[model samples]
Structures are given as C-alpha cells and as structure tokens.
Target: MKIFSENITVPASAIDENSHVNNITYLKWCIDVAEKHWLSTAPKQFQESHFWVVLEHTISYKNPSFEGEELRVETWVTLAEGVKSERSYKITRISDNKVLVNAKTVWCYVELESQRPARITEEIRALFL
Candidate 1:
C-alpha cells in the first residue's frame, strides 16, 4: 500500500491538562491526513462527487508527545470495498522516532449532495492503487 505522510509540530493548543498531546488531537490529525491524502490523490471529478465519513476508529496510545515536538503522521488505505475503506495511521515523534499513536479508521464514501452512502467505483479505487 502507498503511504501518505505529513509532518506536524505539536502545538500548545493541542496539549491537555496532562501537558501532552490530547487524545482528540490525535484523532483530528488522523482525519486531517486522510482527507489530505484523498484530495491529493483522487481525481477532481471524484472529489467533487464524493466525500468520506468516519464509521469507526481504533487508536492505541503508545507514548506521549509534548509541545514543540515535531512528529510524523503517516497513513494509508488498507481496505477499499463497496462503500467503505479502512485507513491506518501512525504518529511518531521525530526526535526519537518513537511511535506515539497507532490507529485505524473505517470510512464510508458518500454522495456530496445527498449525503447517502455511495458505492466505491473502480475508477475511485484505482486512484488509491
């Protein structure tokens, strides 16, 4: 599978009371990277007609990240079938290359206007390939 990666700097706003990156912040980064990957790889027409919605997310916190830390966020589509695709994510602290979070999210394709689940066409799947 092709992997999409983005570098993110841990911001002060992302910190929780514990002084580390918050759980919700990690999820936001996952979703942001997924959208960015799709937008950059998929055809313009496909992007215009379809959008994705998260169906589920499974995240494992392996370590903590602090403000000013540079992290690498990587993601790839693992499964694409019917109307759903599973995307995986890994966030690593750049300083030590230690993984801070590992996650997988299930997303369903939907029509832009109708907002109803839409089938994954061959053309769409080919974009990921």
Candidate 2:
C-alpha cells in the first residue's frame, strides 16, 4: 500500500473549549490529506476528468492532542472496486507516538463533467497500489 503522509504543528485555533484539538479539525485534516494525495498521485487528465465525493466517513478518537504538538497525518487506499474506494487515515502525536485519531472514508468516484458515478480505471488503481 502507498501511504501518503504529512506533518503539522497543532495551532491554538485548532483547540476548542476543552483546550484540545477539535473534532472538526480532525475531519478537516483527513479530507485535506486525501485531496493532497490524489492531487499528487493522479495524472492531469485523470485530475480533469474525475473527482471523489465522500460517501461515508468514520473516525475514532484515542487521545487528545494539544497546541504546539507535532502530529503526523497519514492516509492510504484500503480497497477499491467498481465505483468506489475506501481510504484510511491516522493521526499520531510525534512526542509520544500515540495515535490521536483513526478514520476511514468511502469515496465515490465521479465523472467531473457528467456529475455521475464512474468506475475505477486500472490506471487509477495502479497509482495507489
């Protein structure tokens, strides 16, 4: 599996009333990394012709992360078939190597102009593999 990863230092704005990273922030990070991975891996023609839409998203929180902490965000394709693909995400705190969050998202591939579901082509699948 090809894992796409990036790191970010938690900022004050990401913290909420509980003084920890907000739940929505985690979701945002997951989406951001997924989009980035697709943009970096897919060819220009693929990029122009297709895009992904979220069908389902599941997230589990293991621990709370605080501002100033460096966290690694990673995502990879777990499954792909027909018109959809499943991707998994993990957010870990660097200092303790503790996983703060784990998430999975089911994305439906769509034709950009037609706005219709599209089957995954072998070339697209190979990029992830």
Candidate 3:
C-alpha cells in the first residue's frame, strides 16, 4: 500500500499540563492524516458516492513529545476489504527518531444517500496502491 507522511512541528498549544503532547491532539492528528491520505488519491466521483466513518480506533503511546519538536507522522492503509478499511499510523520525534505513538483505525464505507455499508470495489482499493 502507498504510505503518506508529513512533518509537523509540535505547537505550544498542543502541549497539556503534563508538559507533553496531549492525547486528544495525537488522536486528532491520526484522523486528519488518514483523511488526507484518502482524499489525495480517491476520485471525486467515488467520494461523492460514498463516505467513510470510523468504527474503531486503537492508539498506543510509546514516548512523550514536547512543544517545538518536529515530528514525522505517517499513515497507510493496511487492508481494504468488504466494507471496511484498516489504516495504521505512526508518530515519531524527528530529533531522536523515537516512536511516540502508534495507532490503527477501522473505517466503514457507507453509501451517501442510504448511509448503509457498501462493498469495497477493486478500483477503490487500487486508488491507494
């Protein structure tokens, strides 16, 4: 599968009282990256006909990240079958190259009008490849 990644500088506002990146901030980044990855390659017609909704999220915190640190956030689709896709995420500090967070999210494709689950087509799976 194709891997999408970008570097982000940790903002002061993203740090919580614990003096590190907040849990919610990390979660938000994971979702945002996944959305970007999907939209970057998925055709407009397919997007109009279907949308994805998160069914589950599993995140692990391995290390703490501080404000002003540059982090590498990476995401990729691990599997896309049936009506669901499993995506994985990894966040690491650029300085020490330490893994900060690892996460996986399961998203279900649903029809636009009826909001019912839709089967994954070969074309849709090839979009990421």
Best by lDDT: 2
Task: Sort the predicted structures by lDDT, highest score first.
Answer: 2, 1, 3
State TM-scores per candidate. 0.96, 0.98, 0.96
RMSD of 1: 0.9
Model 1 is weakest, by summed lDDT over 10 consecutive residues, at: 120-129
Kindly list the per-residue Cα lDDT of model 1 for residues 1-129, writing each as its tens digit: 889999999999999999999999999999999999999999899899889999999999999999999999999988899999999999999999999999999999999989899999988777775
- Candidate lDDT values, in order: 0.94, 0.97, 0.92
Which residue ranges in model 2 land beyond 4 Å of their true spot? none
Q: Candidate 3 — what's its lDDT?
A: 0.92
TM-score-sorted candidate list, best first: 2, 1, 3
Worst 10 residues of 3 by lDDT: 120-129
TM-score of model 2 vs. true structure:
0.98
